[model samples]
Target: MQTIRSINLQKNLGDVLRTADVETVLVTNRDQPRAVVMSAEEFIRLKTAAGEPVPNEVRKSSPTLHRRIADPLGYDTRDPGYVEQTASDALDGQHADEIAREIDKAMRRWRLR
Candidate 1:
């Protein structure tokens, strides 16, 4: 809840930012808030704790690719196109079993299994 005029931000940005415990510095223009300056680490920690999705660049650079996808557009989860099946689905029906057997035979022939 720190506020400073735009001119002050330009003059003593570092000092103003250092005064806050949460590192959120509000910049104001003409007595109205215009922008915020905060530490990137703090911002990321807060966003993660709030269950917000990290940016794609952050995800791509991360060591793990297991982050949950956050869709704000309200996608239709019931759509068949959105559903993904596990390998166990290969054993679910006669047609799937036949396909799995063919795949297994091909893998054995190629020494892949």
Candidate 2:
């Protein structure tokens, strides 16, 4: 975490934003915690890691989201509307990648196979 005074952030918006894009920055007012400045990507990633719901505004802001939303063969697993097929045993190619994602999610949360 990086600390940036609210006053400095107002003066150095670009530098602060660029830093926040790669990591979280803690914002403070008069040396007391006040707010946080973070990139939407970091915010979404953190939310996913914590099993928290990401806001629609963050989803809509992504330039590539609309294209992903339109992709039928592609999987936007982050989308709340994403559904796993009922026929898991089929192991057909259509949803193979999605199945892999399921495994990945389980491994990340459980740290075990």
Candidate 3:
């Protein structure tokens, strides 16, 4: 996924929409993801896979108007609930493979892996 700042999205709506046609674009506000813009076909496939009924208007609208943002941790980085830690914490008492696993874990946790 590629990230685009909210201001940039506003300034280049057409370009952003075009990019969304190829891949998911994460729209960010203050460096935190706020929404996702994907191709209409992908959205419908996702909804169908999830067993959610696709309304006529939604099918017509496709990817626009329907907004979905997922944050499994329940908050963004700007929130006080988010904790920032150093890599040293993971390195302590851990072997090389363990350290690699920890790195992989963090990336997967952020859905970036």
Candidate 4:
């Protein structure tokens, strides 16, 4: 990626467009990035990967997902005496045989295959 000031972008539009075809070019205004220039193929690929849901809509619909997105580390380490726990209780030193028995019981209870 390359950063170009707004004035420089205007002066070197042709070269910037050519560069953007190969990689991303960030356009900056007043030293802050204002826009991105990339190939149409790259733009489409990124949009497809991102999916259709807007961030605010997703945040409003699911609080748990919103928290996960806001804190990718699962929990805030900045909290006093914060203890990071594993994602699942089943992984807490359970033997394979015990886990298999629990899974079998759950499957039978739930009528799941």
| lDDT (CA) per prediction | 0.59, 0.71, 0.66, 0.64
lDDT at 25, model 4 = 96
**lDDT tens per residue, model 4, 8-110:** 8878999999998799999999999899998755665575578953344222322124434543333433221223242233356534565576589779989
Return the candidate ranking by TM-score, descending: 2, 3, 4, 1
Candidate 4: stretches off by over 4 Å:
53-113
Worst 10-residue stretch by lDDT in candidate 4? 56-65
**Candidate 2 clashing pairs, residues 3+ apart or interchain:** none
Q: Ten-residue segment with the worst summed lDDT in candidate 1?
A: 58-67
Give model 4's TM-score versus the native structure: 0.44
> What ranges in model 3 sit over 4 Å off?
61-113
Cα TM-score per model: 0.41, 0.52, 0.51, 0.44
Root-mean-square deviation of each candidate, in angstroms? Answer: 13.8, 9.9, 16.6, 14.5
Candidate 2, residue 44: lDDT: 78
Highest lDDT against the true fold, candidate: 2
Best model number under TM-score: 2
- Which sequence of candidate numbers ranks them by lDDT, best first? 2, 3, 4, 1
**Alpha carbon deviation, residue 76, candidate 2 (Å):** 8.6
Writing each residue's lDDT as its tens digit, candidate 1 over 5-85 gives 898776786687676536688888998889887755566566778999867553332221223633222233322222333
lDDT of 3 by residue, 1-113 (tens): 88899988888899889988789999999988899999766776688789997666545422212137343323333222233332343345434565576579789989998
